[model samples]
Target: MNTQPTHRPVALCALIFAFLITTAAADKPTNVVLILSDDQAWTDYGFMGHPDIKTPHLDQLARESAVFRRGYVPTALCRPSLVTLLTGHYASTHGVTGNDPSPKYAPRDSEVYNQRRAKLISYLDRFETVPEALGKLGYLSHQSGKLWEGSYQNCGFTHGMTRGFPEKGGRHGDDGLKIGREGMQPINEFLDLVKEEDKPFFIWYAPFLPHTPHNPPQRLMDKYSSPDRPITVAKYYAMCDWFDETCGQLLGMIDDKGMRDNTLVVYVTDNGWIQDPKKNGYAPRSKQTPYEGGIRTPIMYRLPGKIKPTERTELVSSIDIVPTILAAAGASIPRDLPGLNLMPNLTSGDPIERDTIYGESFAHDIADVDDPEASLLFRWAIQGNYKLLLTYDGEVNRYQSTHPRTEKRPQLFDLIADPTEQTNIAAEHPDIVKRLANKINAWYPVKKRKVLTTFQ
Candidate 1:
């Protein structure tokens, strides 16, 4: 008959609820959405000083995010650049060097310069991705649009609506053309599906727009098309605006589903904008070369409560994305991966731990070379504000130390002073040049063919 005793159980339950609320508030899962644009320029947005490109969504995202003022891609090409982004390793290390058709896809390895054999080896195989690692920690991993080369199915997506891009599929890889709403529609639908799911998700989206064959809806094209403005510029801006609208749509879904505050939204491009091939005197080597116009890209990371709106001049690379996402999700980053966690920067507005970053492009011009495409390699290291680029040609098995002809003397630039990389400071700072060169030379061979080919 002690009815008062029941009050003790109610009080205990209330105390437990308070404790759980405090814990949940202290440790919330950071939902991640990485939006990647193909061939988007670093300075093409309103925030980055484009005179006319309309990117309202990106500009808004920049205001709400930590915008990396000096974001560079490790590779200029999509397949290799993306490989570096996901795996946080260089193409040389990942072994997906050039977009050459591997032996399996080639008429003859010799005929195609033996680029096909390397295509058979995927860069994705070399390391565990952040999403995959997140999945290991009980997070839902979903991706729409471009994930990676031929094997989108095996790129470790829990639920993927990615259509096979040309990079995948062949006798060795799939060559099927992807026309018509490949990833966008599916992305919208996928967002609807996961709105009610109770688990955290990491959505890796790479939209195909503002790339080659610049096509936009007729209405979008008409919105920007005019008689007085530059035709190509108008078209490019139109494409970019349409892409930005798509971003708004995705973000709208998050807001509509009541997930904005809990989500960490990031937007980036695979590489710098491809200088218009149709426009003369725009920039030499639209892509496939390591230039500001080829490597620097737009990056926006908005982790609502975590990252404050600020411009971070500290240089960050695509390599940092892997560790950043893993750290945000409270997932484990594999010891072997070369990426550094960006939690400190995102949460506290601190600089990146890495002072220097490396970039590589293998066999970019191998088709013209007589020897094996695998024999050609390029290496670079950026330290402080200086960068050194080295090119290697000829046999991979016969690398020598003093091949002066093969090794172009290092070209160094003070990035802070000349963001355009127009000045070569290697001759002025001989000591710095020698130090960086030696470091690059020593670290260069670590990503040898043998190391790349070794599969776990």
Candidate 2:
């Protein structure tokens, strides 16, 4: 009899119900599936005007998403570039300039390298990463492949494939490299868990597909094989298609789960790779060089009901991924992050925040993350259609040991008119070169400072 008469209990029940509803809504902002292809060129996809290679799934995804055809990364190598994507900071800021170590420390020889590597991976903890940011806001995340930053837990993922134990024969993504290459069971299981838990999730699908060891199933390879195209080229093309097929399956799962309306799909490459024309290897200028083929990539964001699908030519950077994902999930972005949130541009065709984007091309051997110019090979700036590449060839340039094919002079390219960068107009237009050089210097100061071997 007193159950209906108790007014306080009824009001408390209402408040509790409202709290539950709010918490439930907070856990369902927008699921993010960031698919990163390793060592793929900007022009490799059918949508990006690749004449031979077929990336039908990616092509369709491009059509359905807001595509940035001229997106660029901070570095041309995988480790540094992927770091920028996760942390929303440049290689200069993050202090992870190279793939592994400078020739000084062998990984297994001494704990010196292991200690250094641990220090490098720990730098990720300094900044709030995309997954870490989303994880704070009730999002479960799974790291699938190509992650170099120690462990999945170190980066704040709820669950991941990489243990990242240096003592236990773990270098970088030891068993995690087999996501798309082997199977999708791990990803599928994670999705099922997320479904059962009723929470938003971030999926890092950075598969090491088409990177190296150009091995593909014969069934896929036969599709591109021909007398005109070299077998290497055919195999590379098949690998691209194989990667595309995996993407199709992943996307299909999203649709089947009825999560398309709420899920956000993002696509970008860690760096670019161009298979050599003659030999079965990578071309010099395509990867690890300060060229469009190395640094340029297509940035795509797809949310069915949130963002409209369209192509954008305005320049953007891989660094923007962190801020964009944070903003989408209603999370806080760190103030020092150099990247702009592309939410306005994603929802509407808003103008980009900045006019120019600057980057560095460092040697594979990182002299010091604290010093950009120490291991620096080239300093580049892109403002509008004009891009300037300043190559360092003296004592400062560590890459000189490898005999870089890049010219030892400042080169300028009007990307709109000379997208291929065949002709250098640096001498023809000295004023433009001077202006761009000054702009780059202003963006990233080139003054010398004290050297430190640790991350700043």
Worst 10 residues of 2 by lDDT: 447-456
What tens digits encode model 2's per-residue C-alpha lDDT throughout 77-111?
88888889888888878888887666453543367
At residue 5, give the lDDT of candidate 2.
59
Return the lDDT, model 2, position 419.
Answer: 90
Native-referenced Cα lDDT, model 2: 0.82
Write candidate 1's Cα lDDT for 1-456 as tens digits: 765545778899999999999789657687899888777778888888887778898888889999887887887777777767667676666766555543333355364433444343444665786667777877777665554454445667677654443333432212211312233555556666666567778877676666655667788788878888666666777778877877877787778878788788877787766455356213443455566676788677887776888888887788788778777888777776676787787788766777777776554323322223354445677887888766655332211221233325567778779977777777778787777767766765544332111111
lDDT (Cα atoms) of all candidates against the true structure: 0.66, 0.82
TM-score versus the correct structure, for each prediction: 0.81, 0.89
- Clash counts for all predictions: 12, 0
Error of 1 at 315 (Å): 1.0
86: Cα error in model 2, Å: 1.4
In model 2, the runs with Cα more than 4 Å from the true position are 1-27, 105-108, 393-406, 449-456
